[model samples]
Target: MSAAAVPAPLPLSYDDVVKNLEDLPSLPAVVMELLNSIDQEDVDISVLAKKVSNDQALTAKTLRLANSSLYGLQIKVTTIQQAITYLGFQTTRNLITAAAVTGCFAEGRCRGFDHRAFWRHSIATAACAKVLARQMRFNQDYAFTAGLLHDIGRLVLVASFPERYEQALAYRAEHDCFMLDAERAVLGIDHVEAGMALAEHWNFSDTMRLAIGGHHDPEKPGAGFLAAIIHVADAVVHALDLAQAPDGLVPPVSPVAWNALGLDEAVYLQLFRETELQYEEITMALLS
Candidate 1:
């Protein structure tokens, strides 16, 4: 049957969907606590380290990532404090967030979704965004974070509504259509909405939430600078086939988004090379 012939997903209220997702994997307590304490002036490295250290496994994972070649630390970090110090507050916070978020959905649950490949695409998009941000003279850190989480709502849907999500996946496969389109047709709401819901629950910054919500449709009103970066970054990642699902069709770049960056083809070639290099290194460091 043509995917177009597939019946649209029954309308599910956003609140009901959120409630159904309560059983999905959640961010670690330490990560949540750290997020809560992010704004305190005195939430020193020691306090953060102690919280992470409380979870021995999480600390070990964090330390492993800290020492990985991705960070390029000259000296090895032996403790959570040392890792935090070496990586700095903001980078450390981002690392914690990445680890916590990635760890939650590492195990592939929903059929038809390529869990590892999806994360690879996500990391590649983040790498692309960071590189693009550098070329455009924007905040690389924020770009990377937003790029990494841009498609998180898809994960939320797959994890929370496995059976229904599977049906959406089937539609995409049968029709050879974009996953976002399949999701919208089958779920009545796309990953962007689902991701925004989860982002709100997690208290993500407004900038980050906007990026997630507006990544696919950057031309939407109120879409910020970061949203445009991620929008382009996602397209670039797809162009290179860095990481993606089986039917991960590359979407076209928005002219508005492209014009906002003011980058030329030469910059894109550089980004492609950099994304390939960073994607391999970071994926090994974090997932290996």
Candidate 2:
């Protein structure tokens, strides 16, 4: 019949769903400490570097990214401190957080999941979010982090319960339903809900929790401007085929998102165009 008239999908109990998800890994302690330091009123750049250096893999990723063409620096960055200086505190923090989390999904074998492709999609979404935020004069840094981590729960679910997630995917294909709906039907929860729970457990900022929880539901209460930015960015990335798996749903630009950002068709087109051009460079830097 109609979209809304279709039977409402059954979802898992919050306690049951979240209990299995409670142990999802987070960014390393060093990375979390650095993030806390950077977001503080009085940021200590040296302190941030010290924390990053404690994780050798993170330090290497930070240096590799610093020297990548994304920055186009004249000089090489050999030390974590130098990398931090070159990338700036906020950009460095975002990169470190991304690098740490990416490691968790690097080796997993999720049925019907392509880990590399998933990462590419996430990087593209992050790039699009930053571009949109700058054009719309919102918080570019916050948008970038939100978009990068929005689908984090999917990684957790796939890694923890491959059979269940695969069945969810099958249900989506059979019913011509959205992924979230299928996830809810099979697992009694959707990635959005799972993601929000994880984000809360990690003690992310309210803005980040709201953005991740509502990325697919921009009109939901407390979504705010960040949610709208992420919602539009996620759609743009999927439309461009930036992810490993085909996004089953390519939602139209949310009218609420457009109205909230005051983005007319012309401006939206420009943002989309710019994002495509920058996608490769940003992806390489972040994923290197």
Tell me the deviation in Å of residue 48 in model 2.
2.7
Per-residue CA lDDT of candidate 2, range 174-208, in tens?
99887888887898777887777777767788888
- Candidate 1 residue pairs in clash (backbone atoms < 3 Å): none
lDDT of 1 by residue, 1-288 (tens): 545676645666688668866776778877887767656777766776788878776776677767766577999987877876777777777777876787787455787778888889998898899899889899777888898899999898888888888889998989999988898788787898899999988878888999999998899999999999999999989988877458658898999999999988888888899889888877875676
Quote each prediction's TM-score: 0.91, 0.86
Candidate 2 minimal-lDDT segment of 10 residues: 8-17
Candidate 1 root-mean-square deviation in Å: 3.5
Candidate 2 positional error at 78, Å: 3.4
lDDT, candidate 2, residue 229?
91
Who wins the TM-score comparison? 1
- In model 2, how large is the Cα lDDT of residue 107? 51
Q: Return the clash pairs for model 2, or none.
A: 11-188, 12-188
Candidate closest to the true structure, highest lDDT? 1
